[model samples]
Target: MSADTPYREELAHALRVVHAASVLTKSVLRSLKNSVSAETKADDSPVTIADFAAQALIISALHAVYPADAFLGEESADQLRKNEGLAERVWQLVQQAQFSDVQQRENAHARLVFPATKEEMLDVIDRGTNAQLKGRVWVMDPVDGTATFMTGNQYAVCLCLLVDGVQQVTAIGCPNLRVNPQNPVNVKVHEELVDESGFGVILSAIRGEGTSVRTMLSDGLGEPCKIEVRSSTGGKEIKDLDLIESALGSTSLSQAEHKAVAEEVGAKWPGTVIWSQQMKYIALTLGATDVMLRLPLDKARYTHVWDHAGGQLLFQEVGGIIQDIDGGSIDFSHGRRILGDNNYGMIATQPGVFEKVNEAVKAVLARRT
Candidate 1:
């Protein structure tokens, strides 16, 4: 065990977690969004069997690896299951919502996510809310790219470990992500030169250590190269550099807000935003693009900690950085979630280039304040 020995160990663990998650995600995404039915969660957002399966796999792994760690996840059956008495508890949490006392479980079958059975439902919910949350707990979003997963496009299985509250590590498995789950940082080129459908990308990062990239086809970890944030003077720092964002297809991001950032920064702004949930950060880390800005669609409901944890570290793991619009840090400690999850927008940029982007964002915030 040398200087990088510990890092290598962590890298391996993070890779393992993401790979497990990717296995789950790929299974779900294979059907695309066609097979599963989407239902609104307590949050009034869509959730599917893919989401349930992905989270279940990650939780199962965490329970096996470190049982005592606290766990916080987005989708849980605990509140919706009857035998577990979750429905009654949730009814209270939501201020007296109602559920049916009618025939249950087996009958609801085909249309619902896995574990539609009463006993299975209880297990899912129990696993979900079972957080004692003392030390090194894991945070997960089984299928972070719900829309993409639903559509059979791109999504991710994200898992991160937090000691006490600080994020220590993050593992992202984009089965459809198109990159190797192996060491992506130095894996060379993309599997498909053109970012088309049917490929997966893997990006992993640990706090303090840099980020790495790999394609799905590559194996055994190639020479891991260190990537830097877009440079300030060279190909990286040309002031108004190439901007990459989602296909403008997902409603999660609003074009009106993005256009404003480009206007303020005077950026050239061009490139396709890789659709994979966690792959967005991988793209930025590898120098595919400069920044990824996400403004909250709903002001009252903030972003989830699980939502950004993997992406945040990937940039930091590489030569990039992510900051709230206020230039303050994003809070993962808040077992509670980001405010309005949408109120605080995101800014992802190469190290030096970020300062400029931040300057532009501040101008917008100052005016709003």
Candidate 2:
């Protein structure tokens, strides 16, 4: 490795850990046998056992190789710490996950030990609870869409490397995501472009390096081909643009506002409503959808960092632009939340259409105030 490319080695190590964790998550999902169970978190969101296991698997593996790297994730061990039975269940799940035969037999690092005791497991799970924001932190969302995961629909195992709060690399594992749009897993969108076939795609990108996509079933080590945003017309023409929006409603985002902006821009008005921001970003990169808009229902709420960290960088690296509705860049340095005072959510599109969409959003928002 060259001295100038310090991130090269770390990026490889990160990819390995993320790939292994993706395998673990897929295995855990399979073990569910199609019946999903979830426990509500303090914030009223759903969390499944697979979430905890995936977080522990990835964090522990990376910690072994990069002990100096910090860890931050979505699931915490607080609930498990308060309930021994839950802790035992999660521990058993983690134990059942093992490196694949190829990994164990061919890779020397596979010999590294995993957390053996209940205490160790809980400690590893609690790693995400750390409040530190600065430095080289490994941010992850063990499972991005618990609801979609439960339905055996769309979800993602998202992770990224942020140095001093700026994203440097992003990797996402979409176990059920269709690589080729011709054979879409279950497209809710209006139009179909090209035809392609494959299931489960893994996307990764470094800051300067362009984005690449591969099949996740290959353990994320498959031959990766480069990808870019379809076009950069900036929503210049209504009929030519494809759009996506949030299907699941949240207090922070307004569907009416989304509709208004779509109309303002002469867009089809009723764009595809997709689940999970991570997957929506993937669709944009794959050219499934040309633009994605996320707006808050109100001003008090902020988009969580985990939701956008991986997908945001992935889009930017692929020649797409992502920013707040105000045309400002997203700020990820503010601890766990996006370091911003506004609740505009995010608007993403190729370079040319970004300004057009922003202006339409401004016009729509201006009418409300």
Candidate 3:
């Protein structure tokens, strides 16, 4: 239960669970043959086969180990239950998944026995619909960047363990992210333009335990290495600031407000735009960029807990600070969404420049009013 201790057992279990999910997603991605189709959700977002398979794999693995734990996931089993064709696709991947490969490679402590039938697969996915903020709930986003994933670019499978509404463990698998820091991938690289050599990466953290970076392997995850956030030196000059944003324009802070704030902070104009909320946080964790912001265009747009739960913990554990637009700490105590009614945006940066950027954000947002 303690995040400070090695939590050797918990971290190992989570890595195994997430790594298996990564394998499932990657398999689906490779099968796409350079192009794939998606089904639009009620929210107008895209959902691909990879998303369903990854969520089912992760939840089933965790459920096997912790039967009493609750799950809050992005994709539910309702659609799969009603559509036999879709259920078959997800079930095929689940049945073909080799949990033993991951266990043997990473020496992961958790072992999963795949469900034998489509009914079982649908049941486990449905289990993820639970929206509870009580003790020992796991929040997960099987594919954080569906568009990016479909395009064969960057995407992440995110999972965070929240105990009593507090973030404790974070596990994210970035299958398309590069492991070598020297050859950093462009945050905005298009799918057709992505380099195949980038391979994969896995980032995880426990509250008190430092964040760990590992390369994702075909069989399982690589050995975990500790990672820390680098801070900016000298005074808070706008010129020294760098930005990380969503490449998909609509998902990020208002471009106009972002430009003004970046200009005010002396950050490079426009900043570095990327895909996937989870990947942006990973880039920040790696010291590849400086600031990350998420300002919804509408008042009703809520930040889902599953999206930030893991990314927020990973960033903070690496010396970064994350807060809402009003400069308040992110409250995970609410249900599935983080303060849905409040609808404040999010800002992430190293502690050294957090206040400076916060002030700039405040000024620009004030002018908007």
TM-score of each: 0.73, 0.89, 0.89
lDDT of 2 by residue, 148-195 (tens): 777666788888888888888788888766554233322443222211
**Overall local distance difference test of candidate 1:** 0.57
What value does the lDDT take at residue 93 in candidate 3?
77
> Which residue pairs clash in candidate 2?
182-196, 234-352, 234-353, 252-296, 252-297, 253-297
Each candidate: RMSD? 9.3, 3.7, 3.3
lDDT per residue, candidate 1, 1-369, as tens digits? 246644455556566545544644454444444344576777777776556545554555455555566677778773355223434332232221001101222354211123333454336435756343346667777777676567665566777777766667776766654443343332322213333444355566677766655554322233344455434424544445656666665656556567666778776554455555465765666555667777654466466677776677777765577777656677666564666443366787766777777777666555542
Best by TM-score: 3
Model 3, 1-369: lDDT tens per residue? 354575556677788878888877777777776466887787889988778878878888788778899988999877777778887877887876754454464545435756657888788888888887799888999999888788787788999988888889888988777565333322333223343653477888988887888877776666667774445523446577778766545654587777778887777765666678787787777766778877666567777888788888888887888888876788887887865356488888866888888999888887865
1 or 3, which is superior by lDDT? 3
Worst ten in a row by lDDT for model 2: 189-198
Number of backbone-clashing residue pairs for each candidate, in the order shown: 39, 6, 5
Q: Please identify model 2 stretches exceeding 4 Å from their true place.
A: 1-4, 99-103, 110-113, 180-199, 218-220, 229-236, 248-251, 339-344
TM-score of 1: 0.73
lDDT, each prediction = 0.57, 0.73, 0.76
> Which regions of candidate 3 deviate over 4 angstroms?
1-6, 99-110, 181-199, 229-237, 297-299, 340-343
TM-score of 3: 0.89
